[model samples]
Target: MTLITDTISRAAITDSPLLATLAERWSPRAYDADAVIADDTLTTILEAARWAPSASNSQPARYIVARRGTESFTKIHDALIGFNQTWADSASVLIANVVDTTENTNPWSVYDVGQAVAHLSIQAQHDGIHTHQMGGFDAAALAQAFGLTETQTVISVIALGVLGNIDGLSPELLARESAPRTRKTLDELLLVND
Candidate 1:
């Protein structure tokens, strides 16, 4: 059996080890509509995200979720980018990650939200689930449908499910589906502390 290890050995030096895992956590628009995700599992994923570090200990992040085959889910997907809407149509669940910027005076709140969502995506992968973060969405529409308060700002939409058949995807999507991880070198990222 091929064991997929997250750690890279010195002999197996690559451009970036972090990219290996981060890239492994790629967002695929193609999802299995037939996949059934339990509510408990979804709750746990959110729970992990909730605990991520926030600036000033201000937990301003919130989420509005919807399962597939539901009116809410359909509406949320309808507001997605045309390309994303096409493939995300097959996702098993949808989650709208919102942030309360009114509670946070600093700009770090948005960065904190991104971190929390990143944690959620990584945890989802560990739980045998796949997630796609979408920025190409109508925030106002999602907020309106979910009865969001004026203070709450919608940050991103997440599509979750087991990966769908590659063949079911478009040629363009298929080309991107299995591409290897690419990133900048450490020389460009690190600074010499002389």
Candidate 2:
């Protein structure tokens, strides 16, 4: 594992035995502004998402990627809500996950898109990339900026980059970043009803 991954892993709090990559994976608001991700690396991460399972192979998930310093990136960043915009602006790459809702209304397309995004996140973690998915963006604004049709629904925006100094973040975000991770118990999540 890379030093960044090691540090994140040491800070993670996991309840079960999980793959090292999974355990190390997290959403970091502080990103290395100077870091630039390679095209090949981004392609590999997307490839992982491509292989994720879909309902009857509908394969509705699509990604609109914008590298930092580009107009597209600025558009995506501008669509973000207040707090998210403050932190996500420093990410090296921004990706908007969308789903095609043209053909079928099965509602499973959203789930498929979620799986694809999860795959992308895991692949990124394996590659020592930090990713933070945000739901605080204006979907309509993003669609307008990207020329997405009504058939396309924007699901989420992902901020991708290397970890950066916590001091770069505002005091509130820094405190949240340093806070311990927590999750509900398995019993609370899984229940058998008679």
Candidate 3:
């Protein structure tokens, strides 16, 4: 797929050929401040996560989606700690990926949630929107702010928006944004081939 971005080449030059959606997908920290995701596009992205396979169809995945300039958005952004919330603020949407732990505390529930988010991110990439999932956040503060029950566990936050000018970012963040993306070699990851 043709990557829709106004920045440097961020696509992953994989060791082997892969789907365009998978290869071109990269988390972007800089987002267009004026960008507003269309309602239909936003719903389509969320739908991808909804259809992701869950353990025994338990459907433990849940989300707290917030658009920019809203109270919910402010709360979620404020919950992000020890990180660059300034860049995140420009994102069109912020999603709180959560798990329903009320019952059936199966270990796979967390895995399922991750898969759902992965699907969502890939879909976003295909749709020409950038997604950045962040782990450095205050879960307890977010849980309390959203009035989430004990059973609803917050896992991560996703920032979604159109790619913005690299000049908008600070020197350090710009360097990070432009750094070469790398991953563990396939051989290093495989334990057995038989």
Candidate 4:
């Protein structure tokens, strides 16, 4: 996978090989303000999410997408907290990932939603779009703004767009954006039975 250095200095260097899209996929706070994703591209990304596996084929994951400059987008953006509000505005698309917890209320529903979002993010990366999933948002505020029912649980807010210059970011964020990516080794991650 080609190292991404336009918006950030560091790239995702893995211990072993990985899929190009997975290796290249890294969230950036700097998003191109003027770029708008095509409808077909957005559909393709969502289509990838739509096919994610769920418990009993429940398909509990749901998405509320708000393109840039719409009322929905503004509402979603306004719900961001702290540093997220500072950079998320430049993104071309904001999505609220939610899961239905009404009937089944299965513990695995959250995992299903996470899988769906992961699929969407990887697909976006393959299509040359960057995705940043944020947990620093007001879920209740978003739910109220989006008119989500009590049964729907907000999972995350995803910011999607092309990468942009880091000049506009705060010093702290700029440092974070350019920092080397690291992950736990397999030895640390895996638990072997005696």
Q: Write out the backbone clash pairs for model 2.
A: none
TM-scores, one per candidate: 0.84, 0.93, 0.95, 0.94
lDDT of 1 by residue, 1-194 (tens): 22222222211345545544454566776677799888888888998898999998898888878899999899889888788888888888888888887776687888888999999988887777888899999888888888888889889999989876666777787666645545577677778845
Please give, for residues 1-194, the per-residue lDDT of candidate 2 as tens digits: 12232355544566777888888888888888999999999999999999999998889998999999999999999999999999998899999999997877676999999999999999998997889999999999999999999999899999999888776667798777766778788788888855
What's the CA error at residue 116 for candidate 1, in Å? Answer: 0.7
lDDT of 4 by residue, 108-169 (tens): 99999999999999999999999999999999998899888999978999999999878777
Task: Score each candidate by Cα lDDT.
Answer: 0.78, 0.87, 0.88, 0.89
**Model 2, runs deviating above 4 Å:** 1-6, 9-11
Query: Could you give me the TM-score of model 1 versus the true structure?
Result: 0.84
Query: Positional deviation of 130 in candidate 3, in angstroms?
Result: 0.5
Backbone clashes in model 3: 0
Weakest lDDT window of 10 consecutive positions for candidate 1: 2-11
> What's model 4's lDDT at 131?
95
Highest TM-score: which candidate? Answer: 3
lDDT per residue as tens, model 3, 82-143: 56486899999999999998877888998999999999999998898999999978999999
Off by over 4 Å in 3: 1-8
